[model samples]
Target chain A: MALVELVPNFSEGRRQDVIDKILAAMKEASTAKIIDSRADPDHNRLVVTIVGEPEETFKAGFAGIKTAAELIDMDEHQGEHPRVGATDVVPFVPVTGITIEECTELAKRLAKKVSDELGIPTYLYEAAATRPDRENLANIRKGQYEGLKEAIKTDPDRKPDFGPSELPKAGATVIGAREFLIAYNIYLNTDDVEIAKTIGRNIRHKNGGFAYCKSMGFATKPYVQVSMNLTNYKETPMAMVVETVRNEARRYGVAITETEVYGMIPVDALLDAAEYYLQLNGKWNRSQIIEKKLTEME
Target chain B: MALVELVPNFSEGRRQDVIDKILAAMKEASTAKIIDSRADPDHNRLVVTIVGEPEETFKAGFAGIKTAAELIDMDEHQGEHPRVGATDVVPFVPVTGITIEECTELAKRLAKKVSDELGIPTYLYEAAATRPDRENLANIRKGQYEGLKEAIKTDPDRKPDFGPSELPKAGATVIGAREFLIAYNIYLNTDDVEIAKTIGRNIRHKNGGFAYCKSMGFATKPYVQVSMNLTNYKETPMAMVVETVRNEARRYGVAITETEVYGMIPVDALLDAAEYYLQLNGKWNRSQIIEKKLTEME
Candidate 1:
């Protein structure tokens, strides 16, 4: 089956009633399954994860965006995380039997629909970005809600690819397609947050480290963490990252406490590491998995 | 979905027409997918693998057995491999969301139906065996067709589990349930068969080795092979076996040339090894897989 994963972030998280209404509308409007939903009071935002065929996923995404636009007013929103709209960011990821190009097209279609129908401006980022300047989401969401509200009226570069030039009460949503991202974090034995911050800066892509990694360091009580997003596991696998971090940690006289996978990951990402460590000879395909064959039959 | 895998060995493999007929009948019978089929001319047997929901899988397995019994006659059968019937052995395996006990129940239902409707005596072996001696398939298939033909009528212990004690024209079928078995083989750098034999003896369960392994040694061409059947992967995983064999081979001044997995394997088997090698902290699950979540949603 052609499967796509949709992960969208909303501005409201402190209120359960609004979150429930948006979730209810998403579940009712499309056949896609909402696998995971997290509401963080600190971030004051909600992150919802869903997966299904492209057509159904698009409809579900649109439904959630519509509900978020109706229920949340960005003027009243406050969060620890960056945001530009009530429904902040919607990213389409290729799961199985799907291509990045196909996901890009799906993102564009959803962006246009949400913009035209909901009167919410939308910017395409990542693989579906129309302009080089808007390729990265952080770049498009540079000013946040307040700054973007003024910039949209004065700057031509700030004008969205779709919807009216003026920002609506719901603000603007950033929609795009990208490869599966693995949110991995490794904790250090010592409670030195500075050590973690130094390692994170040295290993992240933006700081000239692994090509697809974005990392930061955080102090969470007992231990310090080198938190990261592996944007493309195929490019820089889990083992390589873990080992590099381990070697880097040794310099600070600290050991790795443990590593964690934050969310759902594609099977191939782990299988690739398995094959490498096991030294499996020759070629092995996913068809060799009984469940994979069963899924294909379905 | 409740998934069950059926691997049936048919007595007639030399004749293409008969094998094709049985294969076609199996495909037409139910929605179960035929994953693989291999006809061994020397053994004069056909091993067909199929997997689906329990009900449909049972129907397809029955259809294949009925077709094999119709096209094959025990009186004229001759082969290198030992067999007691036209449809020699049918093993039901639990693939996903199903237990060995559930598969044992499925095997018994298939056995009773085949015995009563087709007038073919059936013996339940392995997990579904009524007698301790019948638990091992090699023991149940002892004496072959010619020897069992006379013994079933005389020996009380030889009486079939279902149908009449006397053998039919198609002979008797052996049906049962068992855990997924992994057939793995390792080739040694040296051509010394005795080294391979000694290692096999040391690693097999019967010789006080790993509890779930059954191994043998064979000299094929330039290398000697240590062939094994891992009956229960959860008990004795692939990494443990490979490491054991590697340690044993070092004693003989021999290195492992390569290792191979024979057929389809459960994803958990490899994932288990991945976790051990990677040292993933805390509890990790198949739910972390995007495809697994998709399957669950279905």
Candidate 2:
């Protein structure tokens, strides 16, 4: 089975009832498994993680988006997190036996469906972006819902890939296909946030570090964390990044306290590291994993 | 879905047509997957590995055993490996969402069917052993086919678990449930076989080593190998065994050349080592692997 992961971010997170309604609608529409759902009251945004076959996951994502659009009014919605729609962004991540190009096709087809059926403007971002300028999600969501409302009408550059030039009460959704994003946070022994920030800066792609890594520093009560998002684990694996952080931290006389894998990660990501440490010198694949073989049988 | 892995050893490795017929019979009988099959000419035995649901796997195992009994004449069978039947042994390994007790029940049920339907005697071993003496396979298989044939008529202890006192031409089968076995071999850089034998003795269960490990020394052309069967990976993990061997080899002024995982191994065996090296100290489990979650969804 070709597994695809859909993470749809909705703007209404404060109202639990509204998020529950949308979740219920998604459950009704598709056979996809909703693995995780986090509603941050501060951001007022609900991020739902669904994974299944491409068709089912796309349908589930659409159902969630439709429900969010019906219940969440973009004009009244307010959150700390930036958003341009009730269904802010839906990115299809290739999990297993899937390609980014195939996911991009699913994203584009869903974007057209949402535009035609619900009369919602949709912007393509990341791998499915029609225009290179709109590739980054932040670029497409540069202006907030209110700002985009005015800009969509006057600014030709701000026009969406689908739907009317004018924005609707639901606002515009940015849908695309992208690689699996691993939200990993490595905690340092020291309480110094500066050390974390320095390591993050030294390892992030933007700062000429690993190509697929985007890192930042965060301070908790006990320790500092070098929080990272590995956009493409194939290009720059999790272990490599962890090793780099460990090496960098050693210079600051700090050690890695512990590492946290924030959400569900692909089996291959961990298997790669496992094979490396074991120095396995045989033909090994995911099929070797009994559970993985069960999925194939299904 | 609960997974049960059945490895059926048939005493007909010299004949390709016989093993093929047995494999074909299994395919026709159940939906279980034949993950691997090895025919050892020296042993004159065919070890077929099938993994699936308990019911399906049991059915497949019976079909293979039945086919082997019909095709193979055990009286004429000669092999380097010890055996007492055409279908020498059928062990059910609990892979996921299953227990050893459940597998034992399945083993007993299948043993009864084989005895009653096919007229072949069945002896339970390992976790499914009826008596304390039947716990180890070697204990029951001590007399081999010819000796067991003569003993069954007179010796009360040699009586079959599920068949008549008179031994059939096919002989008796040992069926039971057990943990996943990892056939791991680590080669020492030294040419001396004594060092390998010494290391193997230090790591084997009988010699006060790892409780679940069964190790022996083998001379393979240039280097000596510490060939081991890790009967229970959960009790004696792969990494710990490797580390022990590494330490032992260092004591003899030798180093590890390479290691070989001879056959199919469980995912947890590798994941345990990966987590140990990575120091992943958050909420981490096998379900976090995307493929594992897919199995749960099924």
Candidate 3:
């Protein structure tokens, strides 16, 4: 058994009935554990998080897309967040006993299912992209719901990897596979936001920092914060990023006030932190964790 | 569905057939997980580790004891470790949703069962002790098997808590409840044994240090280590212990090399370290961990 995480973003956040119906449909269709469902009215999007076997997650994700298509009209949808479909984007992340390539296969199966059954064109992005042009989600969603509505029928470049090259009432969906993203924030003692910004800039990928990190600085009320989205915890670990932030803060005569993990995070992240901070010399296996051995793979 | 860990020590480690029979009986009798079983020939003892619901664990541990009694004759048993019975001692430790008091009750039930049914005398120690004199395990086994045989029939001070005054072929069994013992060792960068010994002394309870810590210094092949048995992790956490060692090592101008956790450890121990070292300001609950939420109470 494998544990794969699926985070599906739907374009109907303000309407509780629509989200509930979609959630109920997902719960009915799949055996996956629906861990969380968050709706932001400002973004007008509902994001659901689940952990289960790859096939079970696909069944749940497909149900969500089908239900969203039936209830949400893309033309009527308006929000601060960008969208190209009622079910905007769905990503399959490998949790345990599964590889990224395997998740890509699961993503492909989900895209084909939504496109064929719902009569809505679907584009594969990220690891599951059919072409180099469709690799980035920003590329697939370059044209919003209204723009893509016209482009899909005409432009060969705008054509989806599945279904007819025509957009329906639900519009086009972008589905793919990606690593788990950790929403981590580090708070600084100083009131100065400049120091936070500098550390953020030096530690984010675009500025020749850690490869899989995207960070920003903010002056949030009581303390300055260096907020980050760690894209690949295995490649660029949490401990290294934190230690770097600590060392950088010391140069400015400041210390870390506290830290925050914004949402649900895998146990491995904390276990990794334990190994590094405690200076465990790779003398133990993760199986030695009694709870882990007892837990069956999702 | 409370999780309780039971570690049972039997007096025959040199005989593989006897150990196998005991393990098989426990596995067949109880719907509980037998996570580990270690045999130390020098001590001539077998220690089996189990984690399950209180009743299920008690059934499994009882099965092991019954099997050990039938196979091992204590009069012929000789070992480096102190023992008064074929199934020397069994200790129950609380894992999750289970209290020490509940475990003590389970211990008492096991003690009474072995004594009444098996016709072997039983003594309670630690949290399950009937009297102040029986609180220490060493006090209960003051006269090993050979000496305890005559003492049990003659001396009032050496009387057992349960069963007849006459000794059986299997001898006496000791049962009780105690906190989980983590065999943790911290290695220093230097070869100096004195620094390790001093740090060990300052951190152990017997010398007026951390309440539940028991430590000793050892000069292993590569490093001088402060070997420890942390009796209660909730009160004296792993992060606090390691940090204290780091702080103490600084006084001797030595740095820590690495640390080791000898065997099975509860996931909470590592999570405690992560929360402290990462400086999470009570902003996150352990329930927020995806794995923790997915796992049943056990």
Candidate 4:
């Protein structure tokens, strides 16, 4: 069976009734399974992680997006995280027996459906981008909801890849296809934020570090951390990131307290690190693993 | 569906026709999938690894065993590897949605079918053993095919667990249930067999090493290796074994050239090592992995 993953970010997080209703709409599809659903009240956003057949995942995502649009009003929406619409970002990730191109096609198909059926403007970003500028989600959502609404009227460049050159009350939605992103954070023993910031800048791709790594420094209450979004773990790997961060932080006399994986991670990301660390040569395919073989039987 | 794995060792391997007939029987059972099948001419043995629903696996295994028994004659069998019968050892492994107890039950059922219908005397070992002494497979087939025929008649303690005391012309079949075992080997750069033997003794549980590890020294052509059978990877881990061997080999000015995983391994084994080496903290559940989530969707 072909499996694809959908991670849809919703505007509502604090209200249980609204979240439950949106989740119910996804559950109503029946074919897809909700692998994980988390709401950060601080971020004031809900991230729903769903996995199933491509068609089933699309149906479930669409239903959830429609339900979110009905329940949320972007005009009154306030969150620490940036957003454009009730369904902020809907990304299609190829999981198993599926390719990135297939996910891109699914993303485009879903984006068109959202624009035509739901009367909401959608912009294709990442692998599904129609324009080079739309390749990065941050660039596409540069103005957010309020700024994009005004910019759409005056600037031709602000026009979305899908739908009319205007934003609805629930605002605009961004749809795209991308590899699975691993949100990894390594905490330092000291509260010196500068140490983390320096390490983050040195280890991130934009600042001359690992090619596929994007990093930033953040203070989460007690500790300073190097928060990273590994865009392509196969190229850079999670272990290399952690090791480099550890080695860099040591220069500032900062010891690693612990590391946290914020969301879902790909198995290959972990397995690649294992192969390197163990120095295991010869044949060591994931399929050879017992647990993986058992999963195949299932 | 609950999944169980069966690894059956057959006495004949030189003839491709015999191997093909056995595999054909397993292929005939639609529900069971033959994950791997290897024929070692030096051992004159064929090892077929299959996984599927317990009932389907048993049906397939029974058909394969019957085909093997009919074609192979113990009087004509000669091999480099140890053996006592055509279908020497049939071990049932609990894969997914299946417990060890359930595998034990399946082993007994297979043993009964083999003895009743095929006229092959069966001895249960490991988790399916009726007597405590018969739990170890090596102890059951101690004398191999040549000595077993006379030994089974004279020795009361060496009697078959299921069937008549006398060994059939096809020889006695040893059937049991055991945890998945990973056959791993680490080759040293140096041709010093003594160095490999010393490192093997230091890491194996029987010789006061890791609890779940069994080690031995072997020379394969140009390389001398520390061959190990990890009975429980969760307890001992593959990475720890490699590290310990590497550290020990370093004392003798020997470096590990490479490592080999002989057969199917569990995904958890690799993941465990990755987590340890990477120092990834917090709840590291397999459910949080995208590839695992994809498999769950199926």
The TM-score-based order of candidates, best leading, equals 3, 1, 2, 4
In the range A3-41, model 2's lDDT, one tens digit per residue, is 999999999889889989999999899999988899999
lDDT of 1 at A236: 89
Best by DockQ: 3
Q: Which candidate model has the greater DockQ, 2 or 3? A: 3
Per-prediction backbone clash count: 0, 0, 0, 5
Q: Model 3 off-target regions past 4 Å?
A: A14-17, A40-44, A70-80, A116-118, A130-133, A296-298, B14-17, B40-44, B75-80, B116-119, B296-298
What's the distance in Å from true for residue B202, model 3? 4.1
Per-candidate interface DockQ score? 0.54, 0.51, 0.74, 0.54
lDDT of 4 at B162: 78
**Clashes by residue pair, model 2:** none
Per-residue alpha-carbon lDDT of candidate 4 for residues A1-298, written as tens digits (9 for 90 to 100): 5678899999988999999999999989758888889998988899998988899999998998889888899899888998889999999987666788999999999999998988889999998999999998888778788888898778988887778888888788999898878888889998888888898899988889999889988876588989988887767888788888889988888888888887787676788888887767565566677656655666
How many clashing residue pairs, candidate 2?
0
- How far out, in Å, is residue B112 in model 4? 4.6
| Candidate 1 deviant stretches above 4 angstroms | A14-21, A40-44, A70-81, A116-119, A186-209, A214-227, A245-258, B14-21, B40-43, B186-202, B206-208, B214-227, B246-259
RMSD of 3: 2.9
